[model samples]
Structures are given as structure tokens and as C-alpha cells.
Target: MTRLKQLRFEVFGVFFRQCTVDHARQLGLVGWVRNTEHDTVVGVAQGPEAGIADMRHWLREVGSPQSSIASAQFDETDIAELEHESFGVRRR
Candidate 1:
């Protein structure tokens, strides 16, 4: 089953967006990631359940080199198909 998950995470680091996009692409997941004004990163990721799980772990425990993860929250629901074609970075 596929899933569409709302990803809201906080990190005390840089290369956050690059790391996220790279990981998502590597997992064959599609989503957009954006930097928030409050130093938080908000985005959505859609892909297979297994891939999603791996991404979640990377976001929560492991991020870019020297990146410190604060917290990660997800609100997800199963979907019949994916809604995005590629993962990209969004501007504020």
C-alpha cells in the first residue's frame, strides 16, 4: 500500500533540504520539502510503506552530516496511488 504523509520536523542544521530530497529520491519517494520561518521544515512524502518507514527513521534519527534532529511528526493516510512524481525543494 502507498501512503501520503505530512512531514513536519525541526532540525538544528543545514543541508537539511538537500539531505531530505536526496533520501526521498533514493527511496523512490515523491514529495516537496520547504523551510519554515520558525526554523522548522515542513513537507509531504508519498511512496510505499516500507520506503516511508525508512524515510521516517532517517528524518527522526539521522539527517545530513552534522545535522541535529529536534523532533519529527507525521500525519499519514494510506492512498491508492501516489500524487507526486518527484521530490523537490520549495521556497518560502
Candidate 2:
């Protein structure tokens, strides 16, 4: 089953948001990621289980080499539908 997940990343430094977008798109995941007002990176992703897991791995382990990720939190739900066609970065 496909899964939809909302993820929050505590990233220090710059460009992690862009890295998130790049990684998601590369994984063929559909979702949106953006920087929050409180200085956190947040997003939602939907895709096959393996792709989703890969994305999570990227976020947790290889997120922008220029930035430091303090924590990554993910909330996942099994889904019967997908709401996004492609992954992109949003400005908050």
C-alpha cells in the first residue's frame, strides 16, 4: 500500500529545504516541503512504501551535506489516494 506522510525536520544551516525538494523529486515522491515560521522544515510526501522509506532515509541520514539535521519527525498513514502530482518547495 502507498503511504502519505507529514515530516518535520529540524535543520540548521541553509539549503536543506532545497535538498528536501530535490530528494523527493528524485525519488518520484509527490508532496510539498516548506520552511516554517519557527525555523523548521516541514512537508508531506506520498508514494510507494519503498520510495517513502527511501525518502525518510534521505531526510534522516543524508539531508543536505551543508546542513545539520537535529531531528526528523514523521507521521505516516496508509492511503488509498494521492493528492499531489509532484514534489515541490513552498515558501512560507
Candidate 3:
């Protein structure tokens, strides 16, 4: 079974796009993370059950190095297939 998880999160303290992308890829997800013009980070991740769990953990602890995540919301849905192999930082 495959799934698509959409996460809407806010970075308050200090977060960069590169670290965000690396974290998602390490979690074995496919999609992209981008810094919104509003200063929040929005991302979509698609992968297995445990993989997605890793991503969630990462998001929750993203600020230890220098970033502070104010809040995050994750919504999961069934997707027939994923459009990519691994998560990334999207231009859009």
C-alpha cells in the first residue's frame, strides 16, 4: 500500500531549505519542501508507514540545531502511486 502525506508546518526560530530537503530524503519519502513566501515551510511526503514516521519525528525536532518549529500538521491520504522517488526541495 502507498500513501501521500501532506504536512503544513511553521518554522519560527531558524530553518533552512537544504536541511529540510535532506531530512525528508533521509526518511525515505518522495515529494518536496519549500519555504513559503509567508515564511512557513510547506511540504508533501510520500512513502511507507515507518518512513513517514521518521519524517514526522524529524519535523518535530527540526529546531534543535538552530531552527524552531512553531507548529505542524500532517494529513495522510491514500495515493495510487508516487510521482517521485525521493523527497526534495521544490522550486514552487
Candidate 4:
């Protein structure tokens, strides 16, 4: 079954959101990422379990080369249906 994950990325530099969108697209995951007013990056990603896991790992360990990720929080939801057709960067 497809898995859905809501992720919040706390990053210490710029361009994390763009990197996130790129990574998600490359991973073939669907979701939307945006920069929060609180200086955090947030998004929801849904796809195969393995892709979700890879995204989680990337959020934690390997964000944009210009970004220093402070932390990543992931919440797995009961949703099994795809919510988005592609990954995108949402405007604040």
C-alpha cells in the first residue's frame, strides 16, 4: 500500500525547499513543500514505502548542499491514496 508522510524540515540555510522539491520529484514522490513563516520547511509526501523512507532519510541527512538541516519531523498518516500528481514548491 502507498504511504503518506507529513514532514517538517528545520533547516539552517537557504534553498532547502527547492532542494526538497527536486529530491521528491527525482524520487518519484508526490507532494508539496513550502517555507513556513516560522523559518521551517514543511511538506507532505506520498508514494511507495521505500520512497517515503528515502525522503525521510534525505530530509534528515542530506538536504541541499547549501543547507544545514537542524531536524526533520515526520508523521505517518493512515492515508493510502495519492494526494498529488507531482512534487512542487509552494509559495509562502
In order, candidate lDDTs are 0.78, 0.75, 0.69, 0.77
| Candidate 3 lDDT tens digits, 46-86 | 77767777777777765347676776667766666776877
Q: Pick by TM-score: which candidate is best?
A: 1
Per-residue alpha-carbon lDDT of candidate 2 for residues 47-85, written as tens digits (9 for 90 to 100) = 877878888888777788786777777777777777888
RMSD after Cα superposition, model 4? 2.2
**Tens digits of lDDT, candidate 4, 4-68:** 55443444444588888889989898888888787788878888778888988888888888887
Q: Candidate 3: where are CA atoms >4 Å away?
A: 1-14
**Residue 68, candidate 2: alpha-carbon lDDT:** 75
lDDT of 1 by residue, 1-92 (tens): 34454444444444488889999899989989988887777788888888888888898888889677767777767777777789999999
lDDT of 1 at 36: 81
Best by lDDT: 1
Residue 2, model 2: Cα distance from true site in angstroms? 6.3
Question: After TM-score superposition, what is the CA distance of residue 40 in candidate 4 from its true location, in Å?
Answer: 0.6
TM-score of every candidate: 0.84, 0.83, 0.76, 0.83
